[model samples]
Target: MTDLIPALRHLLTLAWQCDPRRLLRAAAMVAAGCLATPLIALCLKGLTTETLAGRGGSAVLLGLAAAALLVLELMMGHFAHLAYFELGDLGEVELQNRLVALAHGRPGLEDLDTPRFADTLALVRDDLPRTRASLEAALQLGGLAIQLGLTAVLLGLLDPWLLLLPLLGAVPVLAGNRAQRLLDTAKESAAPHQRLGRHLLDVATGHATAKEARLAGAAPFLLARHHREWQAGTRLLGRAHTRAAALRAGGQLCFALGYAAAIWLVVRQAQHGVSPLGDVILVITLAAQLSLQVGTAIQLLTVLQDAGRTAHRLDALKPLTPFHANKSDATSAPLVLTRGIRLEHVSFQYPGSTRRVLDDVTLDIPAGTALAVVGENGAGKSTLVKLLCGLYRPTGGRILVDGVDLAAADPADWQHRIATLFQDFARLELRLRDNTGIGDLDRIDDDAALSAALDAAEAAPVAAAVPGGLDGLIGRSYGDGVDLSGGQWQKLGLARALLRRDPLLLVLDEPASALDAAAEQTLFERFARLVADSRARTGAVSVLVSHRFSTVRMADLILVLEHGRLVQAGGHRELLDAGGLYAELYRLQARVYA
Candidate 1:
């Protein structure tokens, strides 16, 4: 009882805060419905009593009242449904938008990577809206209570002992409540298996994995695994359903037997002249109504409780809302780096893990310098990029921009001064112009700037091939869109990054993964030239993360990393001249060409 009130309060507060007017209207309609439903029984009772007494004038009046009540019930039920639906529409959109914003604006990506947080996010996405609409269930529960009370009162007045019918109705109510509890528990337990089954089904059908699946002939394997998971989930749910069915049937049988016995007693009393025929008729009607209301109340209670629990989960996940008057950093405007970035004793380990991805790493990225980071897989290259871009805060030490602390600055404003093209960059599937312009949306419609960015990334020919050029859709999923080859998509990603005019820092992590050796060389050379030109004015710095030594040799400084430790850092010529790990790695890669 203690837990239920707070859970209900959480849902009620959510409903009232979002769209109070619609929620209030829905509540009023529920009350009207509750009042009208019970009055039907009363009007029927009056009509039956009058007719059995042979009172013609009273019978006609009572019959008219019953008809009026039937019309009221119909109208009330319709309006109640309408009001709740309207409220639901408003709440669903608002709550979903808030949940999305919370997940995205939570200040770090670490929480997003965890399984528990993933489950919370999934619930927010698929189920929170239904929880938002639970206000209707809550109000309906209120209506059910009122109906039960009215029916019980009327039955007692028919014969004082007839009040026992409401108590008898409790058996069915308890059974229904228990059944709902079991179902909810089974459903919750099955969620992980259900999710796995759905994921396996997607893997079997997804276009990205189609080639691999076909090559391995693993479609049958995937299907079998999917079926296995589905059975695991359904097995428990099936058991729960079977158990609940038996409980429901048993409770219903008891109610039916008790109802029959009550009717017999009422008829016997009327025959002996202890009670009027009207009294017998009233007892029969109210007895059935009491049972119906009890069952309805139980159903509504289950929904309200489920929604309340979902609401509580959502409340736990809500981020600290950003306010208009938030404390601004000293460098509120986009900062321009004069000296460069300095990483002092930086080390990072992901949440819930002990191993550091970057271990006590230190580096000086001077303004106007081109640096290349060369490392094998799992050498912490991506983690370094994330920390540099403020997607993560270092577990130890600090990143200083010239002299100011990067972590102390506003992440959004800091990020605006930087551009990156990751290996797994996003494929927006938007129009070519919108896709390119996403890097600097303020100039999205600026045709001259768009043309320059596209030309700089050497995507001019690609754009010209499309029928509508910048306005053409770029993916086949929608419209008359054209999907680009892997290499072509990499070039588009480059164009989007290059579109960020006057960026103080640029990081390209394996930006040419899909391109050929010759194409990769040409693209990196062009990028280097572009950086040199931009560096001449804005003191911009560029960092390239690559495995290819041919591309690595062009940078002013080549930083070699191994197993999360900096093994060497120097100019390419100096590194080659020295007989170190960098020299050995360069020689090994040079053998590939030989």
Candidate 2:
């Protein structure tokens, strides 16, 4: 209960962020309702007594007051619901948008892969709505507190001893607090169940895992595991609910006993002529009503306590810092990489890992020239491309784009001037035009530009096959959709990279991996033609990462990496003549296809 206060405060903060005015208005309505509760209760007692005393006109007047109180309660409840819904909706939207922005601005992909960060993401995605609902519950609890306070004041006025009857209801409040603790313990125990549930959901819905599950015939096994997790969660919840019911029953028994005691006191006082019958009746009636309100307040507080715990988890997201930007006015205007893009004494290790993926890697690619990066698996080839693309800042040293330090450059602005095709590129489940056009949204509606990119990537056949040409849906999951083969998908990805009309630097990582030798040659030929055309127009730079030595040998320069260090840097023929790591790997691959 004590821990819950901070959580409640945090939820209030989020609510305030949504719309402070709405919250205030809702609170004001609840306060008015609370102020009216005693009046309504007293009016009922007075109307009953007046009717019994043959004062029909006074009874009629009191009846009208009761009717007005009922109308006010309804209005207050309506406004409260409206405010809560609006606040919850706004908070959920803000939280989701902030999370997406944070994910995009994360310095590296590795940062997003950590378990703790993933857990935080899951909490935000799945638990944020629940937490917001809990906040609404907390607000309702506040209204209940107001009602309880008014009831206490009215009962106290009737008889000082009757006030003790409301205090006796605290036993039930304590019982509810105990039940809430048990519920919290149950939720803690179900954490593993929740984790398993999430894993099952991933396996069931993920595209990549479906093929493996079908081949292994493991759907039944996975389904059984999912069921087991659900059962475990339900079992914990059931046990907690049983305990809550037992505690509530005990509380109700205590409350009943307290009411009986108050009734007996009122009767004894009336018999002793210490109080008039009318006053005794009024006191007894008020005590019963107050007891009911006290019970309701206890229940609401328990709910608020549980909500507070959930709210605390959501509060952790409040301090998520926005992406940092360079203060200096750095224009993203096109600049010639005359001395080439250079990495000087650069090193990088992913967070939580001791092994450095790139170590003191110094290299250069001349402006308007092509460079190919080739290495064996785990040889840090891809990490180099990431560093060059500014996806990851160096752990040590710096990357210079035509002598301008990339670290001091605006990341968002700099990224705009580069086009990238990652090894694990996304296959957008959108229209063909959108898939390519997202690379350059400004020209998304330009049919000529879209057609040019498709032609440059040798993806004209794919575009022709689509029902609506560029406008046709790309994935089978959607209506009127068609899925492409792996090689065709690669072509589409290349088309996307080509769609970036103003890209000064283009990075291609295993872009031709899915293509056959003939297709690869044709694609590379078209790519060369496009680059030659672009060079004639703008002198754009291209960087390729590939395992195919034959494909890379055509590059102006080749880089060989071994165990996170640059081992060879020269033209492909020059490296072969030098008989270094590049030559050894090239010969080894040539032997396989000999």
Q: TM-scores of all models?
A: 0.89, 0.81
User: Which 10-residue span in candidate 1 carries the lowest summed lDDT?
Assistant: 321-330
Worst 10 residues of 2 by lDDT: 317-326
Model 2: residues with Cα > 4 Å off, grouped in runs? 1-39, 60-68, 71-83, 105-107, 161-197, 204-207, 220-326, 329-334, 460-472, 476-480, 516-518, 533-540
Candidate 2: tens digits of C-alpha lDDT, residues 467-497: 9888899888777688789899988998888
lDDT of 1 by residue, 33-59 (tens): 778777877778788878878898999
TM-score of 2: 0.81
